[model samples]
Target: MLKGPAGALHVDDGGKGGVPVVFVHASCGNTTHWAAQLAHLRKRRRAVALDLRGHGKSTLDGGGPISVEDFAADVDAVVDGLGLQRFVLVGHSLGGAVTTAYAAAHPDRVVGLFLLDPASDGRVIPAEQAAGLMQALSTDAWGAVIAEYWAPMLAPSRPEVRERVLSDLRATSQVGASAGLGSLLTFDPVTALRRYKGPRLTVVTAFNQEPNSYQRLVPELPSMQVDGTGHWVQLDAPDAVNTLLDGFLSSTT
Candidate 1:
């Protein structure tokens, strides 16, 4: 575990001396969420997953305001602390937004990026449409919120995959869910995407619940879509996600 400005980040390091691949999980997620990917890819490459502030082992009992930049800074701190060179940055959900912002802020540090169901374009549901979902998350069905919202973002072929994602969702606290979702509501990574020309690929689930914010990037970036998985595609479709990531990493680097 490594300490950052926000809290202690739990990281898993694997592989020998290849370029490092660091993963940032979505809101309400911890490093454990990336277990499937870690288990599969660790033997071939160096991999690391971080628990964002207020999530997982990194708790913010009374931390200051949490901005997208602050989250990006935490990522920067980790990379610098590790003395990593020639690496790829991967992010999912809100972590996607953080990775994009980090890549934009420090383009030189990034060799490529793999964004899984990323939140770069911002919330697709309007404030009005999200009201009900928000209320449900705050009052009842917090776990359901994670499942339902991501259900639309995943491919429909995987029945067993849903349970794995649900387990992680159930672990997220109400305060973290509300606060983390709130942070995502205000973040917009469109400008950052435009500025970054490095090898960038975005993987969107076939049943994307949010609007096609990924489309907005088509003009400025390179991206693709995967089926049979949800917003938490890494968990629901690790094999497919890994295939895409391995190919992308190999091509970009």
Candidate 2:
């Protein structure tokens, strides 16, 4: 575990040294969420996953306001602490937003970016749909959101994956979800996506599912859709995700 501005951030930093990879999980996730990726890729690179403030072993209790800047800073702190001059930065869900912001802020340090089912762009859902999403993400669902979201947001093909995600989600700090999601609404994806030009790829679950914001990158952004999975593609389809991830890492490096 490493110390950040807020508190202790549980980090898994092991494996042979090569190009380092730092993983940031979704809003309601912890370091444990990236276990499979770390284990599979560790043999070749220094893989690290950090629990964001208020998630996993990190403490968010009574912490100051949480925003995209703070999230990005946490990532920066980890990178500096580990002495990784340059590395592959991967983010899932809201973490995608964080990674994008981080890459923008420190383009020299991020050799590539792998965004997993990040929030989209160019269109906002109807008020009714947005309300439903808010309701589903209510803190009350922290304990049961996994089951509720599994069928709708994840693939039925990976029940075990869903369960594992559920464990980490339930352990996340209650404040973390709302805080992170709030940033999703306010942050400017278009502006952020334009900030960096390093090798970038966005992975989604279905064809044409890449965030509309990222789509703007077009030929510039090489994206792959690993389906038979959901938002948590890394968990539902590790083999496919790893295949894509490995290729991206190799090509970018």
Instruction: Give me the candidate number with maximum TM-score.
Output: 2
lDDT of 2 at 103: 91
Model 2 Cα lDDT, one tens digit per residue, 1-253: 6778776667778886778889999878877778889998987878989988877777764644577768888888888888889999999988888899899889988989999877665235556765666566665765465456445775555778777777766666557766666567556666777788888888866633544646544546666666567678777777777888888888987
Candidate 2 Cα misplacement greater than 4 A, ranges: 61-64, 122-151, 155-157, 207-213, 216-219
All candidates' TM-scores?
0.85, 0.86
Q: What is the C-alpha lDDT of each candidate?
A: 0.73, 0.76
Give the runs in model 1 whose Cα sits over 4 Å from its true position.
63-65, 123-148, 154-159, 209-211
Q: How accurate is candidate 1 locally (lDDT)?
A: 0.73
